[model samples]
Target: QEVVKRTPGEAEFHQAVREVIDSLGPVLVKYPEFGEAKIIRRICEPERQLIFRVAWQDDKGEVHINRGLRVQFNSALGPYKGGLRFHPSVYLGIIKFLGFEQIFKNALTGLPMGGAKGGSDFDPKGKSDNEVMRFCQSFMTELWRIIGEHTDVPAGDIGVGGREIGYLFGQYKRLTNKFEAGVITGKGLNYGGAQVRTEATGYGCVYFVNEMLASRKEGFKGKKVVISGSGNVAIYTHEKVTQLGGKVMAMSDSNGVIYDKHGINLDTVKLLKEVQRRRLKDYREYHRSAQYTPNGNIWDIPCDVAFPSATENEITGKDAKKLVKNGCIAVGEGANM
Candidate 1:
């Protein structure tokens, strides 16, 4: 039925869907139970796709508008679960990829969740806090009606964080007139958020590496590590790595990388990232001992471990080869690789 509905202009979309469906053909052929389950025939189509216009007022009192989307791809296994990204790079294609990937990721986690994703093309950077709050509230106003604890649960991703989640959840509660604790997962601790939830992804990566090393009677103790990005994952990764007795050689942002061979002072990194909300380039002004390599490649630095805690495809085949050649024994992907 989905194939019959495809048109020539949707050629690219059809091709992508077909590729995924084709990949499942082998599995269905190998397992008669999967065929009995009718999984292959239902592989590519999304359960629901929502597109809405988000209009809000800027700090200047100028009316601004943007498109918002929520692709609730599948919910056969459980309720919808994914992140809300806000960036100019967002589009239907990108949201589909993210939602599709979340299905398998959730399955692997052994959590009661199915695939879904949502976001807008609105960039939160350089905007006033009030402006951001207004945008988040507007986004949530439409989104809350379709999501809930047992229905759908959204979390933080990319441009969405504690601030964004706060505004979103506040708006949700105000509109629904109900305080559902599990409606969102990344809320502040005082508001029923789990401890270490913010650091879960990064810290879990380190923990997995530690376990793998223990299996081989090795560890990260006294080893030099280089981590990319200055977000929550990167900042917390630097913290856990240093706590486990490893020196983080460098950290980077989209603009460039910062090389601090002595060690990336965790507190100072947090100050530059969390407190100041500035770019990684600003780290140099405070910690002069740390070498600031503007617009540089972080993988070029020598290290025993490498954590790419940034965006998708940030580390390519060439970056992998460089890490291997530089003697990096362990690599972790905090976000999409």
Candidate 2:
């Protein structure tokens, strides 16, 4: 109630706070000092929040404007570290919610990193390479003032990937006249990025799920998996699951779902999504047996395990019920969802 009152219209942030508060009963009871010192309250509020203007010119010489955001939620552990997402759905509430989640995520790793998130509502889907570069340059013009290797370090998320990161890093270097490779992660290997960083999130998720299944004397050797989203996480997740002997029956994009009975071909998916940036519907051209359903409910497909590796709040109550009814034995989240 207090969260909602303080941050009206920020439903995602409110829900994030409520989720943490609701889970703290045991910790509050055991420590009591945390509550007495108002640590929870401090954690709920961001250390700093910056919303800025990102104005760039399109190919047609028309100027477009977008709002960029960075919420330095907490730095109790160390410097702020998080990804910068570029999506039309991004807002203050979504970034706050993501930053809130990042605090615990970093803490769990016991890494000397804090929590922060930065992004803009810019959609880079149809933009040309030069247009994307101009946008990154304009964005970094303002962003460079606040970020550094020892301060907040931003990486790629969703619409922002290696291409975006390269452009952003180039702009950062050009602005500061310094080649500080440590200022960002997920850079191309020719730059300073660590190898396997691109596959880390997806591979790690599968490894974590493997451990969970091991606890129950089960594994992915013969499981049928359904992963939502055809982006980085989903693509690599499909790769790792297939390597682990699981048959990934379906994968989806925002527009539709692709169902392949024999299993999805990662090579073809990589070509279509990564290189060409085409839709899932084009997948049928490569594999005749593959079925593409436009705007279909992926949850309706039966599977042994489900990976909601898409956006947040994608799996609603009804979706959960449908998955259970379809005999989904486990669920592992590979995205913010």
Candidate 3:
């Protein structure tokens, strides 16, 4: 395990990695076979971590330089697999957490994949489509050399979606001149994307919850569910819950949450998220009766089931207590914790 501390600023991330490694030492010693196989020690560190400078010109013709990283953690089972996140909050600590979690999650899937994660701290919220494409192209220009179909495969995460992936894949293909289908996942359907890939995560959560309910002799029929976050996961989770006969009472984002006690209109929620790409605050304008609580807590609202499909740590122990007190029977987590 090679531990390279880039600078004093990366202390937090380094400390986190050290803590995780320390915790795993006991487990490694307990499983003598794993120690003999060197699996635990081998899994404690990333195989490779590439940090590069990305320079791109903004629409205003101003040159901006951003740091990018691709952490190919391990490939013990198969090729490295994870998502590429692009957000202002991205950093070494966040990426490392996601990458470490991916290692175990991929193993649980019974898939032949190891673990990796990459991204930058570039916010795409207000940027034009052209600007986003340009940035992605520039980012991929450097990233392509380090990744391939059998090397490390990256998919979509917080800020990287279809548009970003399209720009990235185009750049990769242009540079390598290789039409590799398996090099990336979460691609457009017309271009070798698997069916139900888009809705897989969100829908899978709903399906698991349904099974849990069935096991307990209960189902989603007429149940009131509260979903936080209006992104792809939240939107699709809302859709699936509705399909299962549950009425989604609310959905939220960073701006706020909108509660429709009369039952959430799935079509309207879709319009706000999919078509408009707007915040949940705008939902109240269309439906006057829907209560829009700006910057308010979604867990405060009463519901039967709670799905915190937003970012990590959004639902803390405090929020969990509130949900349990509010009669929340089941809680679903979508993001990497």
Top candidate by TM-score: 2
Which candidate ranks first by lDDT, i.e. highest?
2
The TM-score of predicted model 2 comes to: 0.98
Candidate 2: tens digits of C-alpha lDDT, residues 1-337: 8778888999888888898899999999999999899998899899999999999999999999999999999989988999999999999999999999999998999888999999999998879889989998899999998889898889989899899999999999998999999999999999999999999989999998989999999999999999999999999999999999999999999889999999989999999988998888899999999999999988999999999998888789999999999999889899984
Model 1 agreement with the true structure over 57-126: per-residue lDDT tens digits = 9988999999999989789889999999998888887777778777878889897899888999998877
Which prediction has more favorable lDDT, 1 or 2?
A: 2
Q: Which ranges in model 1 have alpha carbons more than 4 Å from their true place? A: 1-26, 35-38
Instruction: Quantify all predictions' global Cα lDDT against the true fold.
Output: 0.83, 0.92, 0.84
Give the 10-residue window scoring lowest on summed lDDT in candidate 1: 6-15
lDDT of 3 at 168: 92
Q: How close is candidate 1 to the true structure, as a TM-score?
A: 0.90
Candidate that beats the other on TM-score, 1 or 2, i.e. the better one? 2
